[model samples]
Target: MPFTIGESVLFFGIISLTTIVIRFLPFILFPENKKTPGYIAYLGRVLPYTIIGMLVIYCLKDISFTASPFGLPELISAAVIIVLHLWKNHTFLSIGAGTIMYMLLVQFIF
Candidate 1:
Protein backbone atom coordinates (compact mmCIF):
# COMPACT_ATOMS: atom_id res chain seq x y z
CA MET A 1 0.00 0.00 0.00
CA PRO A 2 1.20 3.49 -0.77
CA PHE A 3 0.78 6.43 1.52
CA THR A 4 -0.55 9.69 0.13
CA ILE A 5 1.65 12.77 0.42
CA GLY A 6 -0.44 14.18 3.25
CA GLU A 7 -0.28 10.87 5.13
CA SER A 8 3.52 10.66 4.69
CA VAL A 9 3.91 14.19 5.93
CA LEU A 10 1.72 13.50 8.93
CA PHE A 11 3.68 10.35 9.73
CA PHE A 12 7.03 12.09 9.51
CA GLY A 13 5.73 14.97 11.55
CA ILE A 14 4.61 12.65 14.33
CA ILE A 15 7.97 10.85 14.28
CA SER A 16 9.90 14.10 14.45
CA LEU A 17 7.80 15.39 17.32
CA THR A 18 8.17 12.11 19.18
CA THR A 19 11.95 12.18 18.70
CA ILE A 20 12.18 15.71 20.04
CA VAL A 21 9.98 14.91 23.01
CA ILE A 22 12.04 11.85 23.94
CA ARG A 23 15.29 13.75 23.60
CA PHE A 24 14.16 16.54 25.88
CA LEU A 25 12.08 14.58 28.38
CA PRO A 26 15.02 13.59 30.57
CA PHE A 27 16.19 17.12 31.07
CA ILE A 28 12.65 18.25 31.74
CA LEU A 29 12.14 15.54 34.34
CA PHE A 30 15.53 16.06 36.03
CA PRO A 31 16.55 19.63 35.62
CA GLU A 32 20.09 20.67 36.53
CA ASN A 33 18.91 23.04 39.26
CA LYS A 34 17.16 20.27 41.20
CA LYS A 35 18.63 17.28 43.03
CA THR A 36 17.83 13.82 41.66
CA PRO A 37 15.62 11.53 43.69
CA GLY A 38 17.37 9.03 45.96
CA TYR A 39 15.61 6.02 44.45
CA ILE A 40 16.60 7.01 40.94
CA ALA A 41 20.18 7.47 42.06
CA TYR A 42 20.17 4.06 43.75
CA LEU A 43 18.76 2.41 40.61
CA GLY A 44 21.45 4.04 38.53
CA ARG A 45 24.08 2.59 40.81
CA VAL A 46 22.55 -0.90 41.04
CA LEU A 47 21.11 -1.58 37.60
CA PRO A 48 24.40 -2.25 35.86
CA TYR A 49 25.37 -5.17 38.11
CA THR A 50 21.80 -6.44 38.09
CA ILE A 51 21.73 -6.35 34.31
CA ILE A 52 25.08 -8.15 34.09
CA GLY A 53 23.86 -10.88 36.43
CA MET A 54 20.70 -11.32 34.39
CA LEU A 55 22.72 -11.53 31.18
CA VAL A 56 25.01 -14.17 32.64
CA ILE A 57 22.04 -16.29 33.63
CA TYR A 58 20.43 -15.79 30.22
CA CYS A 59 23.62 -16.80 28.40
CA LEU A 60 24.15 -19.96 30.46
CA LYS A 61 20.55 -21.12 30.52
CA ASP A 62 20.75 -23.52 27.55
CA ILE A 63 23.89 -25.58 27.93
CA SER A 64 23.54 -29.35 27.52
CA PHE A 65 26.03 -31.43 29.44
CA THR A 66 25.05 -34.76 27.82
CA ALA A 67 25.26 -33.58 24.22
CA SER A 68 28.09 -34.20 21.72
CA PRO A 69 30.05 -31.09 22.50
CA PHE A 70 29.01 -31.47 26.16
CA GLY A 71 28.93 -27.72 26.77
CA LEU A 72 32.72 -27.61 26.70
CA PRO A 73 32.76 -24.72 24.28
CA GLU A 74 30.53 -22.61 26.49
CA LEU A 75 32.40 -23.55 29.64
CA ILE A 76 35.75 -22.83 28.04
CA SER A 77 34.54 -19.52 26.72
CA ALA A 78 33.21 -18.53 30.14
CA ALA A 79 36.47 -19.46 31.78
CA VAL A 80 38.36 -17.44 29.22
CA ILE A 81 36.17 -14.45 29.91
CA ILE A 82 36.70 -14.77 33.66
CA VAL A 83 40.43 -15.16 33.35
CA LEU A 84 40.81 -12.28 30.94
CA HIS A 85 38.64 -9.99 33.03
CA LEU A 86 40.52 -10.89 36.17
CA TRP A 87 43.95 -10.60 34.60
CA LYS A 88 43.43 -7.46 32.56
CA ASN A 89 40.36 -5.84 34.14
CA HIS A 90 38.94 -4.97 30.74
CA THR A 91 35.27 -5.82 30.09
CA PHE A 92 35.40 -5.34 26.32
CA LEU A 93 38.56 -7.39 25.90
CA SER A 94 37.18 -10.28 27.95
CA ILE A 95 33.78 -10.27 26.25
CA GLY A 96 35.17 -9.89 22.73
CA ALA A 97 37.80 -12.57 23.27
CA GLY A 98 35.25 -14.92 24.79
CA THR A 99 32.84 -14.40 21.88
CA ILE A 100 35.55 -15.08 19.33
CA MET A 101 36.67 -18.16 21.25
CA TYR A 102 33.11 -19.51 21.39
CA MET A 103 32.57 -18.94 17.66
CA LEU A 104 35.85 -20.64 16.79
CA LEU A 105 35.07 -23.58 19.01
CA VAL A 106 31.59 -24.06 17.60
CA GLN A 107 32.63 -23.66 13.97
CA PHE A 108 35.95 -25.51 13.83
CA ILE A 109 36.53 -27.58 16.95
CA PHE A 110 33.18 -28.71 18.27
Candidate 2:
Protein backbone atom coordinates (compact mmCIF):
# COMPACT_ATOMS: atom_id res chain seq x y z
CA MET A 1 0.00 0.00 0.00
CA PRO A 2 1.13 3.51 -0.78
CA PHE A 3 0.16 6.80 0.82
CA THR A 4 -0.13 10.14 -0.84
CA ILE A 5 2.01 13.11 0.27
CA GLY A 6 -0.78 14.56 2.39
CA GLU A 7 -1.56 11.28 4.07
CA SER A 8 2.12 10.55 4.69
CA VAL A 9 2.66 13.99 6.19
CA LEU A 10 -0.35 13.67 8.45
CA PHE A 11 0.66 10.19 9.61
CA PHE A 12 4.25 11.18 10.32
CA GLY A 13 3.14 14.37 12.02
CA ILE A 14 0.92 12.43 14.39
CA ILE A 15 3.71 9.90 15.04
CA SER A 16 6.23 12.63 15.76
CA LEU A 17 3.86 14.44 18.06
CA THR A 18 3.11 11.21 19.93
CA THR A 19 6.80 10.39 20.22
CA ILE A 20 7.63 13.81 21.57
CA VAL A 21 4.78 13.72 24.04
CA ILE A 22 5.80 10.28 25.36
CA ARG A 23 9.47 11.25 25.58
CA PHE A 24 8.77 14.42 27.55
CA LEU A 25 5.85 13.12 29.59
CA PRO A 26 8.01 11.96 32.51
CA PHE A 27 9.80 15.25 32.81
CA ILE A 28 6.58 17.18 32.45
CA LEU A 29 4.80 15.16 35.09
CA PHE A 30 7.74 14.95 37.49
CA PRO A 31 9.70 18.14 37.63
CA GLU A 32 13.28 17.98 38.87
CA ASN A 33 12.63 20.50 41.67
CA LYS A 34 9.55 18.71 42.96
CA LYS A 35 9.56 15.68 45.25
CA THR A 36 8.49 12.49 43.47
CA PRO A 37 5.65 10.40 44.90
CA GLY A 38 6.61 7.61 47.30
CA TYR A 39 5.17 4.84 45.14
CA ILE A 40 6.91 6.10 42.04
CA ALA A 41 10.17 6.49 43.91
CA TYR A 42 9.83 3.00 45.40
CA LEU A 43 9.17 1.52 42.01
CA GLY A 44 12.25 3.24 40.65
CA ARG A 45 14.29 1.75 43.47
CA VAL A 46 12.87 -1.82 43.40
CA LEU A 47 11.77 -2.46 39.83
CA PRO A 48 15.21 -3.41 38.52
CA TYR A 49 15.63 -6.30 40.97
CA THR A 50 12.12 -7.59 40.33
CA ILE A 51 12.53 -7.25 36.59
CA ILE A 52 15.75 -9.24 36.70
CA GLY A 53 14.10 -11.96 38.76
CA MET A 54 11.21 -12.10 36.30
CA LEU A 55 13.58 -12.38 33.38
CA VAL A 56 15.51 -15.18 35.01
CA ILE A 57 12.33 -17.10 35.62
CA TYR A 58 11.19 -16.48 32.07
CA CYS A 59 14.48 -17.77 30.72
CA LEU A 60 14.21 -20.98 32.71
CA LYS A 61 10.52 -21.47 32.09
CA ASP A 62 11.18 -24.29 29.59
CA ILE A 63 12.89 -27.40 30.84
CA SER A 64 12.61 -31.10 30.07
CA PHE A 65 13.77 -33.45 32.78
CA THR A 66 13.61 -36.57 30.60
CA ALA A 67 15.26 -35.10 27.52
CA SER A 68 18.85 -35.30 26.41
CA PRO A 69 21.21 -32.81 28.05
CA PHE A 70 18.41 -32.38 30.60
CA GLY A 71 18.52 -28.62 30.95
CA LEU A 72 22.22 -28.71 31.72
CA PRO A 73 23.01 -26.08 29.12
CA GLU A 74 20.71 -23.50 30.68
CA LEU A 75 21.71 -24.38 34.22
CA ILE A 76 25.38 -24.16 33.35
CA SER A 77 24.86 -20.89 31.56
CA ALA A 78 23.06 -19.45 34.57
CA ALA A 79 25.87 -20.54 36.85
CA VAL A 80 28.44 -19.02 34.52
CA ILE A 81 26.55 -15.74 34.40
CA ILE A 82 26.28 -15.72 38.19
CA VAL A 83 29.97 -16.46 38.65
CA LEU A 84 31.04 -13.87 36.10
CA HIS A 85 28.79 -11.25 37.62
CA LEU A 86 30.12 -11.95 41.11
CA TRP A 87 33.72 -12.12 39.97
CA LYS A 88 33.90 -8.84 38.09
CA ASN A 89 30.55 -7.18 38.85
CA HIS A 90 30.43 -6.37 35.10
CA THR A 91 27.04 -6.56 33.40
CA PHE A 92 28.20 -6.82 29.82
CA LEU A 93 30.82 -9.47 30.49
CA SER A 94 28.46 -11.66 32.49
CA ILE A 95 25.59 -11.48 30.01
CA GLY A 96 27.82 -11.70 26.95
CA ALA A 97 29.77 -14.66 28.22
CA GLY A 98 26.67 -16.45 29.43
CA THR A 99 24.87 -15.89 26.11
CA ILE A 100 27.82 -17.12 24.11
CA MET A 101 28.15 -20.17 26.33
CA TYR A 102 24.44 -20.96 26.01
CA MET A 103 24.52 -20.56 22.22
CA LEU A 104 27.43 -22.94 21.94
CA LEU A 105 25.90 -25.46 24.30
CA VAL A 106 22.56 -25.58 22.51
CA GLN A 107 24.04 -25.65 19.03
CA PHE A 108 26.77 -28.22 19.63
CA ILE A 109 26.22 -30.10 22.86
CA PHE A 110 22.46 -30.55 23.03
Candidate 3:
Protein backbone atom coordinates (compact mmCIF):
# COMPACT_ATOMS: atom_id res chain seq x y z
CA MET A 1 0.00 0.00 0.00
CA PRO A 2 1.08 3.53 -0.84
CA PHE A 3 1.04 6.31 1.76
CA THR A 4 -0.06 9.83 0.94
CA ILE A 5 1.72 13.05 2.00
CA GLY A 6 -1.32 14.30 3.90
CA GLU A 7 -1.54 11.09 5.89
CA SER A 8 2.19 11.24 6.65
CA VAL A 9 1.96 14.84 7.82
CA LEU A 10 -0.98 14.00 10.05
CA PHE A 11 0.84 11.02 11.52
CA PHE A 12 3.95 13.12 12.17
CA GLY A 13 1.94 15.93 13.71
CA ILE A 14 0.10 13.57 16.02
CA ILE A 15 3.37 11.95 17.08
CA SER A 16 5.05 15.30 17.69
CA LEU A 17 2.12 16.57 19.70
CA THR A 18 1.99 13.40 21.77
CA THR A 19 5.72 13.58 22.44
CA ILE A 20 5.55 17.21 23.49
CA VAL A 21 2.61 16.53 25.77
CA ILE A 22 4.22 13.51 27.37
CA ARG A 23 7.51 15.30 27.88
CA PHE A 24 6.19 18.56 29.32
CA LEU A 25 2.77 17.67 30.75
CA PRO A 26 4.17 16.60 34.10
CA PHE A 27 5.98 19.91 34.57
CA ILE A 28 2.84 21.82 33.62
CA LEU A 29 0.68 19.75 35.98
CA PHE A 30 2.97 19.79 39.02
CA PRO A 31 5.22 22.79 39.11
CA GLU A 32 8.45 22.75 41.06
CA ASN A 33 8.54 24.20 44.58
CA LYS A 34 11.03 24.72 47.35
CA LYS A 35 9.32 22.14 49.57
CA THR A 36 9.64 18.67 48.06
CA PRO A 37 8.58 15.44 49.78
CA GLY A 38 10.98 13.42 51.91
CA TYR A 39 11.10 10.52 49.44
CA ILE A 40 11.65 12.85 46.55
CA ALA A 41 14.42 14.66 48.38
CA TYR A 42 16.09 11.34 49.16
CA LEU A 43 15.68 10.25 45.57
CA GLY A 44 17.10 13.53 44.32
CA ARG A 45 20.14 13.06 46.50
CA VAL A 46 20.77 9.52 45.24
CA LEU A 47 19.73 9.87 41.63
CA PRO A 48 22.91 11.59 40.41
CA TYR A 49 25.13 8.79 41.69
CA THR A 50 22.74 6.22 40.30
CA ILE A 51 22.80 7.92 36.91
CA ILE A 52 26.59 8.14 36.93
CA GLY A 53 26.91 4.47 37.80
CA MET A 54 24.48 3.53 35.05
CA LEU A 55 26.39 5.67 32.53
CA VAL A 56 29.73 4.15 33.53
CA ILE A 57 28.33 0.64 33.34
CA TYR A 58 26.79 1.36 29.98
CA CYS A 59 30.10 2.68 28.65
CA LEU A 60 31.95 -0.42 29.84
CA LYS A 61 29.31 -2.95 28.90
CA ASP A 62 30.89 -4.06 25.62
CA ILE A 63 34.51 -4.02 26.79
CA SER A 64 36.47 -7.23 26.53
CA PHE A 65 39.33 -7.97 28.92
CA THR A 66 41.47 -9.61 26.25
CA ALA A 67 41.02 -6.86 23.68
CA SER A 68 43.87 -4.45 23.19
CA PRO A 69 43.22 -1.03 24.78
CA PHE A 70 39.78 -2.42 25.73
CA GLY A 71 38.39 0.99 26.72
CA LEU A 72 41.09 1.36 29.37
CA PRO A 73 41.22 5.09 28.78
CA GLU A 74 37.52 5.43 29.45
CA LEU A 75 37.90 3.42 32.66
CA ILE A 76 40.82 5.53 33.74
CA SER A 77 39.01 8.73 32.85
CA ALA A 78 36.00 7.65 34.86
CA ALA A 79 38.26 6.89 37.82
CA VAL A 80 39.92 10.27 37.48
CA ILE A 81 36.55 11.96 37.35
CA ILE A 82 35.45 10.07 40.46
CA VAL A 83 38.58 11.06 42.30
CA LEU A 84 38.30 14.69 41.26
CA HIS A 85 34.68 14.75 42.22
CA LEU A 86 35.52 13.33 45.63
CA TRP A 87 38.40 15.69 46.17
CA LYS A 88 37.08 18.95 44.75
CA ASN A 89 33.33 18.26 44.63
CA HIS A 90 33.09 20.07 41.29
CA THR A 91 30.77 18.31 38.90
CA PHE A 92 31.21 20.40 35.76
CA LEU A 93 34.98 20.68 36.04
CA SER A 94 35.38 16.98 36.73
CA ILE A 95 33.19 15.99 33.81
CA GLY A 96 34.84 18.50 31.48
CA ALA A 97 38.34 17.35 32.41
CA GLY A 98 37.36 13.72 32.14
CA THR A 99 35.83 14.22 28.70
CA ILE A 100 38.83 16.18 27.47
CA MET A 101 41.20 13.58 28.84
CA TYR A 102 39.24 10.79 27.24
CA MET A 103 39.15 12.54 23.89
CA LEU A 104 42.86 13.27 24.00
CA LEU A 105 43.65 9.70 24.98
CA VAL A 106 41.51 8.34 22.19
CA GLN A 107 43.03 10.72 19.66
CA PHE A 108 46.67 10.36 20.67
CA ILE A 109 47.06 6.93 22.25
CA PHE A 110 44.32 4.83 20.70
Candidate 4:
Protein backbone atom coordinates (compact mmCIF):
# COMPACT_ATOMS: atom_id res chain seq x y z
CA MET A 1 0.00 0.00 0.00
CA PRO A 2 1.16 3.54 -0.83
CA PHE A 3 1.67 5.86 2.15
CA THR A 4 1.90 9.63 1.98
CA ILE A 5 4.54 11.44 4.09
CA GLY A 6 1.91 13.12 6.26
CA GLU A 7 0.15 9.83 6.96
CA SER A 8 3.44 8.14 7.83
CA VAL A 9 4.36 10.92 10.26
CA LEU A 10 0.97 10.81 11.94
CA PHE A 11 1.05 7.04 12.18
CA PHE A 12 4.53 7.03 13.69
CA GLY A 13 3.65 9.88 16.07
CA ILE A 14 0.61 8.03 17.36
CA ILE A 15 2.64 4.83 17.84
CA SER A 16 5.44 6.72 19.58
CA LEU A 17 3.03 8.47 21.91
CA THR A 18 1.22 5.23 22.70
CA THR A 19 4.49 3.41 23.45
CA ILE A 20 5.78 6.26 25.65
CA VAL A 21 2.57 6.49 27.62
CA ILE A 22 2.29 2.75 28.10
CA ARG A 23 5.91 2.38 29.20
CA PHE A 24 5.96 5.37 31.58
CA LEU A 25 2.39 5.45 32.86
CA PRO A 26 3.11 3.33 35.94
CA PHE A 27 6.19 5.35 36.95
CA ILE A 28 4.35 8.61 36.39
CA LEU A 29 1.17 7.63 38.21
CA PHE A 30 2.48 5.49 41.07
CA PRO A 31 5.55 6.95 42.64
CA GLU A 32 7.71 4.51 44.58
CA ASN A 33 7.97 4.86 48.33
CA LYS A 34 11.25 4.76 50.24
CA LYS A 35 10.24 1.53 51.88
CA THR A 36 9.64 -0.95 49.09
CA PRO A 37 7.93 -4.29 49.77
CA GLY A 38 9.90 -7.49 50.33
CA TYR A 39 8.95 -9.02 46.99
CA ILE A 40 10.05 -5.92 45.09
CA ALA A 41 13.33 -5.76 46.98
CA TYR A 42 13.99 -9.41 46.15
CA LEU A 43 13.13 -8.74 42.51
CA GLY A 44 15.47 -5.75 42.43
CA ARG A 45 18.32 -7.86 43.80
CA VAL A 46 17.78 -10.65 41.26
CA LEU A 47 17.05 -8.45 38.26
CA PRO A 48 20.65 -7.46 37.58
CA TYR A 49 21.89 -11.05 37.29
CA THR A 50 18.88 -11.92 35.15
CA ILE A 51 19.48 -8.99 32.82
CA ILE A 52 23.21 -9.70 32.51
CA GLY A 53 22.63 -13.38 31.83
CA MET A 54 20.08 -12.54 29.16
CA LEU A 55 22.46 -10.09 27.51
CA VAL A 56 25.37 -12.56 27.52
CA ILE A 57 23.21 -15.33 26.12
CA TYR A 58 21.84 -12.99 23.46
CA CYS A 59 25.36 -11.98 22.38
CA LEU A 60 26.64 -15.57 22.21
CA LYS A 61 23.54 -16.99 20.53
CA ASP A 62 24.97 -16.44 17.04
CA ILE A 63 28.42 -17.83 17.79
CA SER A 64 29.44 -20.83 15.70
CA PHE A 65 30.87 -23.95 17.35
CA THR A 66 33.52 -24.29 14.67
CA ALA A 67 36.68 -22.31 15.45
CA SER A 68 36.87 -18.93 13.75
CA PRO A 69 39.44 -16.18 14.23
CA PHE A 70 36.76 -13.52 13.90
CA GLY A 71 35.24 -14.55 17.27
CA LEU A 72 38.49 -15.21 19.12
CA PRO A 73 39.23 -11.57 19.91
CA GLU A 74 35.88 -11.03 21.57
CA LEU A 75 36.20 -14.29 23.48
CA ILE A 76 39.68 -13.41 24.69
CA SER A 77 38.61 -9.93 25.71
CA ALA A 78 35.60 -11.21 27.61
CA ALA A 79 37.77 -13.78 29.35
CA VAL A 80 40.25 -11.10 30.34
CA ILE A 81 37.49 -8.96 31.79
CA ILE A 82 36.02 -11.90 33.68
CA VAL A 83 39.36 -13.00 35.04
CA LEU A 84 40.39 -9.51 36.10
CA HIS A 85 37.09 -8.87 37.78
CA LEU A 86 37.27 -12.17 39.60
CA TRP A 87 40.90 -11.94 40.67
CA LYS A 88 41.44 -8.23 41.26
CA ASN A 89 37.86 -7.17 42.01
CA HIS A 90 38.37 -4.02 39.96
CA THR A 91 35.35 -3.28 37.79
CA PHE A 92 36.62 -0.20 35.98
CA LEU A 93 40.09 -1.56 35.41
CA SER A 94 38.70 -4.83 34.09
CA ILE A 95 36.33 -3.08 31.71
CA GLY A 96 38.89 -0.50 30.54
CA ALA A 97 41.60 -3.06 30.00
CA GLY A 98 39.27 -5.43 28.23
CA THR A 99 37.99 -2.67 25.96
CA ILE A 100 41.50 -1.50 25.09
CA MET A 101 42.61 -5.04 24.44
CA TYR A 102 39.59 -5.65 22.25
CA MET A 103 40.25 -2.50 20.25
CA LEU A 104 43.92 -3.36 19.80
CA LEU A 105 43.13 -6.92 18.85
CA VAL A 106 40.51 -5.83 16.33
CA GLN A 107 42.79 -3.19 14.81
CA PHE A 108 45.92 -5.32 14.57
CA ILE A 109 44.82 -8.95 14.47
CA PHE A 110 41.54 -8.65 12.63
What is the lDDT for 75 in model 3? 86
| Reference-based lDDT, residue 94, model 1 | 97
In Å, residue 72's CA in model 2 sits off its true spot by 0.7
Clashing pairs in 4: none
Give the per-residue lDDT of model 4 (tens digit) for 4-109: 9999999999999999999998576546755666787788689988998899879777766576665788889999999999999998999999999999997998
Candidate 1: which stretches are off by over 4 Å? 1-48
TM-score of candidate 4 relative to the true fold: 0.62
Rank candidates by TM-score, best first: 4, 2, 1, 3
Superposed Cα deviation of residue 1, candidate 3 (Å): 18
Give the clash total for candidate 3.
Answer: 0
TM-scores, all candidates, are: 0.54, 0.55, 0.54, 0.62
lDDT of model 1 at position 43 = 85
lDDT of 3 by residue, 1-110 (tens): 26699988888899999999999974765568656667777886899888988986887798776897887887889898989999999989999999998998889997
lDDT of each: 0.92, 0.92, 0.85, 0.85
Once fitted onto the true fold, the runs of candidate 4 whose alpha carbons sit more than 4 angstroms away are 1-8, 11-15, 25-45, 60-62
Of 2 and 4, the candidate ranking higher by TM-score: 4
| Tens-place lDDT digits, model 2, residues 1-110 | 39999999999999999999999997889888999999988987999989988997897888876887888999999999999999999999999999999999999988
Estimate the lDDT of model 1: 0.92
Q: Considering TM-score, which of the candidate structures 1 and 2 is the better prediction for this target?
A: 2
Candidate that scores best on TM-score: 4
